[model samples]
Each structure stands twice: as C-alpha cells, then as structure tokens.
Target chain A: MSLSPLGASRSLAAVFLPIKSGGLVDEVCRRIELAVETGLLTSGQRLPNEIELAGALGVSAVTTREALSQLRGQGLIRTVRGRSGGSFIADDALPSPERARARLLDLTRLQISDLGLHWRAIAATCAGVAARRSDAADIASLRGYIRPAAGDGQGATALAWRLSASEFMLEVAAVARSARLAREILRLQADMGTLTLLPFGDPAFCEHIAELSEAVTAAIESHDSGAAEARTRELIQTTTNWLLAEHAAGQAHTPGTTEEEAS
Target chain B: MNGNDAAPATAELRTLVEGIEGRIDDWAAATTRWLNDAGKLSGSAIDKFVRPTVSDMLLAPGSNVTGAGFIASAGLLGPDRSYIAWWQGEDLERVDALANFSPQSMSRYVGAEWFKVPVATRRPHVTGPYIDLLCTDEYVLTFTHPVFRGDAVAGIVGLDVTAQTLERRALPLLRRIGPRAALVSAGGRTIVCAAPDVDAGDVIGPAEGAAATPIGRSFTLLAAAAVA
Candidate 1:
C-alpha cells in the first residue's frame, strides 16, 4: 500500500462522507478536484492506491476507478504503466491565464467580492490558528518554501514559483490543524490561481511576496496571531485589489451598463 | 493543579449550557405545539397560520425575537415570493407579513450557515452573530428548525434574535463560569464572550473537557474555565 501523509486519508474521508443529497459521482469528482486544487493532494503524489482510496471513501472500487479515470481524462491526474506506478496529480495542471480570465469574466463584481470575503476569512483564521499551533518542524517547512528563486522569465519557471507560493500557504493551512479551513483555503487558492497570474513577471511583485512571506513567517514563529492575520490579509488584499480593478475596467468597456449596477 | 479548583469552573459552565439547552428545548416544544394546533404545516400554510401569530408572541417584553417565518423549500423563496414575517425592531410594533426576501437580500441569507446546515441535516441549528444586511441589517442569531411533514422535510421555520439580546443573556453566565469563558458556535466562531480579552468571531481552539455541549441540534458551545 502506498503511504499517505499523516491524517491525509482521514481528512479526505471527512470531505467525502456525510454526503449531502447529490450526484455521488459528481460529488466525488469535486472533492478530489478540490483536494488537488488546494495542494492538499500535491503534484506527483500518488493517490492512496485505487482500492485504498475506494475503501477510505466508502465507494466501490469501480466507482473509485471511474473517478480516477475522470481525473486522468481531465489532465488533473495521470497513470503510469509500471509495477510501482499509481494515479498521480499531473505536474503541469495549472490553469492557463486565458482560462482563468474567462472564468473571472463570468463572475459579477459582487460575486468576486463575495469570493474575496470568504477567502479573507478562511486565510486569516488559518493564519491565526497556524501561529498558535505551529511547531519547530512546521516553522522550518514554512521557511523552506519562502527562499527566493530566480524565475528566469520562463513561463514554466513562473508557474513553478506560483506553485511554490501556493505550497507555502497550504503548509500554513495544514499546520493550523483545521481541516475544514484548509479545504476552504485550498479551493480558494485554486480559484485565485488564475487571478494571481496577472501579477506574475513583475520583479516588484516578486520582491513584495518574498518580504511578505518573511514577515508572516516571523510573526507565526513569534506566536503573534494578530500580526500573522494582518500580514496574510495584506497578502490577500494585494490580489483582491487587482481583481476589483480588473472588474472595474471590464465594466467600463461594456456599454449600456448602468452606473448604479456598476457601482 | 488541585481537582477542587477545576471542579467549580466545569460545574459552572455546565450549568450555563444546561440553561441554554433548556431554552432551545422549550422553543422546540412551543414550535411543535404550534405545528400540532395548525393541523397541517405546509409551505403556504406557514404564512396563513403561523407567521402573524408568532411575530406577535415573539414581541413580548424581553422576548428578543426580531423575525419569524418559514422557508418552504430550497427554491421556495424567489426574490418576490418570500414567506417571512419580520418586525423591524424591539419597538417596531408592526410586522411586515408580505415583505419580499429580495434577490439582493437573499445574497446574505441563502448560503448562510443557518440556512444551509439545517436543511442538509434535517435538524435544528443556530448560526450567527453575523450581520444580515439583507434582512435585519444587524448582528443576529438565526435559529432554524426543519419542518418535517411525515417522514420527509417539507420546509423550515426560522427565528432571528439580535446578538445584543443573546449577549445579554449569555454574558452573566459566562462571567460566573470564569477565570475566562466564551460561548462558541459549532463552526468555532465566538458568539458571546465573557473572556476579557476575546471578541466575537474570534477563532477559538478546542477546549479539553471544558463544559462543552451541543446546543439546539447543531451548535457546540464551549465554556471553558481555562484558556482554550
């Protein structure tokens, strides 16, 4: 059996079971999609081999296999033909900027603001909890992700930096010990993944991210939940401000839109 | 630490929890009686039989009830056909029975913890200290109970209470329970607090063996003697 991370199987189970009235298959797909999106199921990490996943999720092996096939078909996961291979999240599953922009365009300004509100709540709460609960090992892992990396202006390099930054935030969420909040942060991070692409390639943005990461880490290490939340909120606001500006620009371009509605 | 010092705090918090639970049970019983007397509680019947009377009964002195009504089903209330009887405030004697639960207003209530959780579980739930700009436009506590007609859930009946009233009700008990005390929601939002330094909506960690108990059918209130 492939070894899953500590409490990972349990947390995944929490997501699946207590299934509300809905399509089971679609629900299963969403949970797995969200898990992968949040980096809770990291890139290249093999899922709890098919049978194990089926057992843990309380679904039939056929159902599990079908879900895995769906993920593979969607390019979110892949299967290798070998003795040791299993279903794994694909390394290059990040959404393209165009895809993200299209998604953003689909939302109303109010919806975007609502999403931002939820994201801020979960992220700030996670920051506070992480500051209170993080141990030395957690601190070390957090620090490891913050070290500066040269992007070289390549698309792949920028993607890697984005993923690393997400990993750092996910680590904080995971360390906070609230699986529920972690799940939320993960989903929000995935949704914001595309939005974050806008600020990429800016050296000033990169420098700001590094400074923020360092500051957040110091606050958490010093057990300052208030500082940790404030810094995280600032980081999230950076994206929120950008999204609001983009939304306003979109409104300006679309004629016949009412001033009241736009506001 | 000596066992004696810890005993009183636990006992005190437990007593407060019991009082709240008793209140919830009383409300549940009163609702049951109302349903029974109405002969049949249906989506349309809620407006005809229940809304007007409950609004009046709830307005009794010190009764804190701001809004009382029923949600017929998941998609029952469109922007225009909203079925709620809401009093504007404690002194607002008039209740608006035909008020529309507007589309813009629905933004704040539809996916809220109070609405979503109870409907899904078919159980009673309490969610709040949240500002409802759509309805009351105040920090309010929403108490919801799923209306079961036979085996299936037909709709839901909900009541809104101002956070100020809940705080007034809970704080004295918390003060007595301290060293430090708080009434935390199931989602870990601190609703009413007697802890000097903590505020509502503060994220509270789990308290071990504190006088923690589930209120209504879905919320867990933790009144810890020690810092949690």
Candidate 2:
C-alpha cells in the first residue's frame, strides 16, 4: 500500500479525526474506541502517542490523554511502561464472528447501501486509475498479492483469505496514483472493518475474491481501465450481495457457516 | 511582491519542458516517417530503426532521454499481437515488455496512457511524472506521439526522461519562483516542489490559482502555500 515514499498515512489519520465541532474529547474517545471494537486497530497495533494523536485528530493534547486513559480503563488499549511505551490495542481485541455479526446486525439496510456505494466508487476508481498509471513494477507487485489462502485444511483459511484480500484491495488503491482515493478506501475499510471481511469465510466467496484479484490485476496490467474498473465493482457487489443476504437472515443461523453461503 | 521574481523562472521551466516535448515529438515523427515506407513491420524492422537512433538520443551530450522506441498496436505482429521495441538502461539495452503475447497478454500495452492518449487525441501527449517502475526505475515523464498506418494508429513512439533529470535541470530555475514554488502536472500532481513537507507526486489540487503559470501542455509552475 505504499504510494508515496515519504508518508501515506497522514491522510489516513485525517479520516479518523472528527471534522465537526462538539463535545470534542468524548467524540474523539468514542470514535477511536469504536474503531477498536470494529477491528480497525487490530491486536498489538499502537495508537500514536498523545501529542501526535492530538495533532492528527486536531484535538487538544489533554483531550487525547484523557481519551487514551478511558480506553485503557475499558481494557481496549493497554499501555506499555518503557522507553517504547505507548498505548496499544489489547491482544484479546481480536476480530471475531461475534463482533462482525453484531456490527453487521447493527447496520440498517440503507446504511449498508450507502457503504456499498462509497466502497464501489473508491474501489472502481482505484482500478481505473491504476490501469492508466501502473508501470511494470506496479503490475509485478500487484501480481504478488493475488495468491489465495492455501487449502491447508487448517481451518484458519478464512482469516488467511481475509488478510490477503484486504491487502490486495489496499495495494490496488495505492497503485492508482490518487492518494485521496487510497485514503478514502482505507477509511471505508476501517469503517466497514470486520463485517466487510465476513464474506471471506465462505470458500465460494474467497474463490470469487481470488478471481477478481487476478482479473483486476490483469486488467490493470493490460492497461484496460474499463475492465479493471468493472472487475473491481464486481468484487464489491459480490461481497455486498452476500452481506445483504445475511442482513435478510439476521440471527437465524450462525455466520461463517456454509448456511450463510447457501442463503 | 514575489510574483515578479517567479516570472522569469516560470518561463525558463516552460522552455525546458517544451524542449523535452520537442525532442519527443521529433522522435515520434521520425518513427512515423520510417513506417510510412518500410512496407512491413517486424522485430528486425524495428531494430534497424533503434540501432541508428537510440544511442544518439540517450548518450548524446546533455541528453536526458533514458528510454525510446516503438510500442506497436494490437495484432500488428501476427499472433504476437502488440509488442514493445523499447530500449532503456544505462547501456541502452533492448527490452520487450510482452511475455505470453497471447490475445490475453496483448491487453497490457494497448491501454497505457502513453499510447492511449495520443491515439485518442491524434496529437502528442505527455504522461506522468510518475515512478517508472518499468523503465529507468525512477520518476519519469513519458512523452508519446502516435504513428499512423493510413487513417488508423499503427503504434506509438514514446520517449522517457527521468523526473530527477528534469528536477536536477529545473531546480535552479524553479528556486527563482519562491520557496513554495513547484512544477506540477496538468492534474496538479507535483513533479517537484521546494516546500520541505511536499514531496513530488502529491497532488496539490488543480493549478488554477493566481500563483500558477502554465509551463508546457502538461505542466504548471505554481507558488502553492499549502502542501496537499
């Protein structure tokens, strides 16, 4: 996902910062705490130090400090106590089907539709632009990200596919030459978080993800913007349709099960 | 005001960019001239063109050209579809980007903006101050012009010049504009900037402000204050 040699994450940091004014500290604390719950801050990832956080979030340093302490109290972030010490997400804050289902169940149909529109727009635009802007190295690097989770029968292949598919999504955005688009996709990925990845648990869905991965890379390599874009949208639409089906059958059956795929 | 100071530098960069454009268009025109009478095109047909020209373009005194050659249109080479006759590197080695060249593989070059834009416009086009990743392995500005067979485009003739070369050659001229001065693409992606926080390739937004002056068809010299 490296786009610029300098810093690509500044825009990512901007996405989490509250754009409107209100009860600033509570809002800052709530947004980040929700980000953690939704798996945006994965296990072991460190939150930026308070001052850095304050600047990026555009909140007061005191506000950032207070928020960090609140998160620590909630067992969301555990701070280390050494030279390298900073707030880190607790190891137990792993993404789970429970969290993903709960989050997905919380979202209304209109909300999911809104998210899909935004996701498809950014994803498709990235592919189209990447097709035009990519060079041989971009093509080579993108090709490397297309490997699907091995059929190891080890039972964690769902998470494995999720990790690789998510990385491929981000990589395509970075290659697009639009940092703005990359940052937006990163934001959407964060907002959708674990719920967006639930479909990867299904072997059929993972196959589709892998196919789209290969197709989009080929289209970009071939410099076919139209095909690259259409394949990207197809990738999202496949996932969206799966999620909508789950939304329709809420709590009726276990997710991450073949039944979800069957529905 | 600093506006007056930036004026001369803007004109200088315009000259520099235009010079690069002129060289690329000349190469493209030379290619079209050869194809007009060559009868049929093939790998050897293109090699003869390169053996006579690539060295002069890449190693000539003060030359910035790093890669130059023909990118053929799809299906122009029998089952081979399209192929690149591009030569690059310090020694000017010949490199062909196609591997399988299957109907599937041919899709790769046909859509490259370097080839696509000129075909669409029927005029010379400049693409990227982007990382080349393919040739020269540096930030590159690719200038491409179409080669025609009858009324249809048969191929493109492209020239690659590293952004570093342009920056190294343009920085002194750019500094006269002011500390925040930058050379940006037509789309406002910075090719070079004096601001410490802004690196090349970050879009500074559309260069329509009073601070911007057109450099070439593809670039602008802007005294932007904010680093986007």
Candidate 3:
C-alpha cells in the first residue's frame, strides 16, 4: 500500500499549516479543501485507496478512514465500496451552511480584524457576479427578506431580525451561483452573528443594521453591480469594527471588576 | 353470356397487369440511385446524415433519444447495450434480438450469422431480403460499405432503407418484377426481401446466374476494382 507521489505531495502540503489543530479529522478536512482548491482533485475525480492514502500521510489506516468519513459528512467527498468502486468527489458538492459557520467561528476565535478583511474581499467579488447575472425577479426575491422589527422584541428575536437584514446582502452572493462564494458568505455571517449576539443590548447595533439595509437595497435597485459589492464589503467591515470595540471595552471593565474583588 | 362476361374480366386483369409493370420500372430506377449515392459518401458523411435523420425521426414522434455517439472501446459492452449510439425507434426493444443475432453470441438468427461476417470475407456481398423480427411486416434494407480512414478498415456504414414503404408506393410496378428483389449488404446480408417467407438467418452466399440480375436496382454499384 505504498502511496503515489501525488498523494505524498498533498499530504506534506496539508500538515501543520498554521491552522487550528482539530486533531487528525480536522487535518484531513484541511487537506481535502487544499486538494480541491489546487485542482489536484476535481469534481468526480476518484481518490486513491484508503490504505494508500494512510500510508502516504504516515498515519494509521483507521485514522485515515475516519478522516475520510468526516469529510463525507461535510459533503466534501463520497465513498463507494465494491469492485470497480472507490471514493470520489461529488460533482455538485457544496459545503453546508452549518459547516461554513463552524469554520468561521473557529477563525473568529483567533482574530476578528483579519476575518473582516477576508470577508470584505470575498463578498465584493460575489456582488459583482450576482449583479451581472441576476434578473429582476432575483432582486425582488431578495427584497422579501427585509421586514421592520417587531415592537417589544427582546433578545433572540431582535437579533434574528438583524440577522434577517443580512439576507439582502447574502442574496447577492447567492445570485453569483458560485458555490465557493456562498459557502464563504455563510461562514462569515455565522462568525459575525455569534460575536454580535452578546452585544445586541447596544443601540448602535440596530442603527448599523438600518444603514446596511438601506445602502444594499439602493445599490441593488440601481443595477450597479460594483456599487452593490462595495457597499456590502463596507457594511461588513463597519459591523466587525463596532463589535471588536465593544468586546475590548467589556474586557477592560472585567479587569477593573476583578481588582475590586481582590481588594 | 359466358363469352361476354369473360371479356370484361380479362380486360380488367390486363389493366392491372400493365399498372404493376409500370411500378416495377420506377422502383428499379430509384433503388439504383439509392445504392450508388450511399456508396459514394465517406463514413463521416454517412454518420452526419444518420445523426440528423435519426434525431428528427425520434424527436418528431415524441420519444426521448439520449446518449448519441459512435460505440467503441471494450467498456461499452455492458448489459444496457451501450455499444450502439442511436437507441430510439421500434428497434429499441430489438436489443435482445440484435445481441442474439451478433456473431459473437450463440443464438444468432438464420440470416444474422451471414450479416456478421466481415466485409472482407464476403466480397461483393449483398444481405437481406429478410424480414426484421421486431417489425415483422416491414422489411429493412441495409446498404453497408467498408469504411476506411487512411489504410485501416475502421468499420462499415449501414444505411437503413425501408423496403416495405417503398413497395407499397411502387407496388404496381414491383409486381411485374416477380416480387423477388432483395437489397443486400456488401457482406451478403439480405437487408430487404420483397418475398415475405424469406428467412433472414439463412446464408445468402453469392447471387448466381439470372438471379444476379437486379430487377429494380437502386443502390450504387460498388466498383469491384476499387475494393482491394
């Protein structure tokens, strides 16, 4: 079960790559993503035997198999057993929104600013593609997501409404019809939502949502693809900055409270 | 009274015979042209003709025809009959018959074995004059020509000629020709037989003596000199 040269190269490239260590399973997921991105594997391309891949990666066959299974659960790969059968990449495989969200959450725990910068770049590109391809009906469907906040709303409901406002922007990404863009948007939104959920009591959050909704709608209605994309990126960055500032202020107050307790 | 009655009957029979004689002449002319034109075209040109004709015929009748391309490679020999590119029409169900008739298969029908014999072995071959098992009433005539691209014999192009419909339209003339005309492939496979009783599975071999005389010849005569 010696590994092929191609498999060995892929294995070396994916290991200890400065990403979070989720153990063997997470490492396999990273490798699969890298393989897809680099075009080493394409849709419908078959993977080597489990034993071969394990030997190449210098890991036990059982660990490699479990990693492959985890990748399958994420809709990244599929396995077929029997004669004339093996694991293959699904032609129409797209990461689920939940998986995207998990990845974003993992990134946010390390650095919010860096995540915001990446989100801006990705969303801008999506907006351009959506504007070029989307018809009037697609724009109308996006408008349906916007609704006024309910009176006397508290906690999750208010947060939910704010999140719903983000859909106008998300709809732009959807129209691009790029699976990669959609997955990345879902990841960014998930991370942003998680961070903002704690600070919803602040009035600035609601005001920021209102501004974002107006800017996105105006750009989209004008049929300006570039403007729409730029507006989306700007809004996301602004929101991220606001959340980071709030988190830092909270951290400062926590230290003061701790000193008082010690005294 | 008997003489007078016989005269009228005789007169009617004469007119019918004359009409049949005229149709036979027309069929002979048409068949000659069909054979000549089909033989002159290259394999690629024939395939081009088949694609459009088959597509129009199948789609016009509201049947979904899919997976069109030439059959090649060993992997195509699946249970689903993926070898033949074109799949629509009454011949769809005849996959089993075709499989059986294939020389590779043991259950080959009477004329089927002769048809499978390579064109090289049956020089100046003419097939058919036999009924298709699937379409029991309609006779299909195939004119097969050796396909060559460069120095190789790639395959053969078999053009389906519907003899039953042709006979109906030119029946009056065909009747005068003894209704025994056959359209055969180069491999000696009888593609269309006017006579209903002819078994397709029987070895047709080579035409002999006066029987070799084409009554209503339409196919283009292959230049015997050209086939090396």
Better of 2 and 3 by lDDT: 2
lDDT of 3: 0.47
Candidate 1 per-residue lDDT, tens place, A70-181, comes to 8888899899878997777789765456666667666788888888888888888888988986657568878877743444323434455666677677777755755457
State the TM-score of the second chain for every model: 0.68, 0.88, 0.37
lDDT of 3 at A186: 65
The lDDT for every candidate, in the order shown, is 0.63, 0.73, 0.47
The CA lDDT at A13 in model 1 is 80
RMSD to the hidden true structure, all candidates = 20.3, 19.6, 26.9
lDDT of 2 at A62: 90
Query: Which pairs of residues clash in candidate 2, taking residues 3 or more apart in a chain or in different chains?
Result: A222-B107, A222-B108
Error of 3 at B2 (Å): 68
Ranking by TM-score: 2, 1, 3
**Residue lDDT tens for model 2, A78-164:** 999899998887988666777788889878888998899889998999899888767676787677667643543235456566766
* Residue-wise C-alpha lDDT for candidate 3, range B109-141, written one tens digit per residue: 212322343235422123343333322222444
Tens digit of per-residue lDDT, candidate 3, span A1-263: 88998999888988857874458767656666654532335578677667756644546788778888887887778888789889888776523334333433344324878777888888888777666555554567566655433542334354445545555556666555454576677667655644544433455566566577567666766668878788888777776776566555555555566478679
List the lowest-lDDT window of 10 residues for candidate 2 chain B: B96-105
Q: Which pairs of residues have clashing backbones in candidate 1?
A: none
Writing each residue's lDDT as its tens digit, candidate 2 over B1-228 gives: 266877777777888889988877777777777777788777657767855677778778888788887777875666546766777756776553322122333453675678888888888888877645345545578889888776778788888887778878877776777777788887667788777766666657533464666777778777664654
**Model 3 chain B worst lDDT window (10 residues):** B219-228
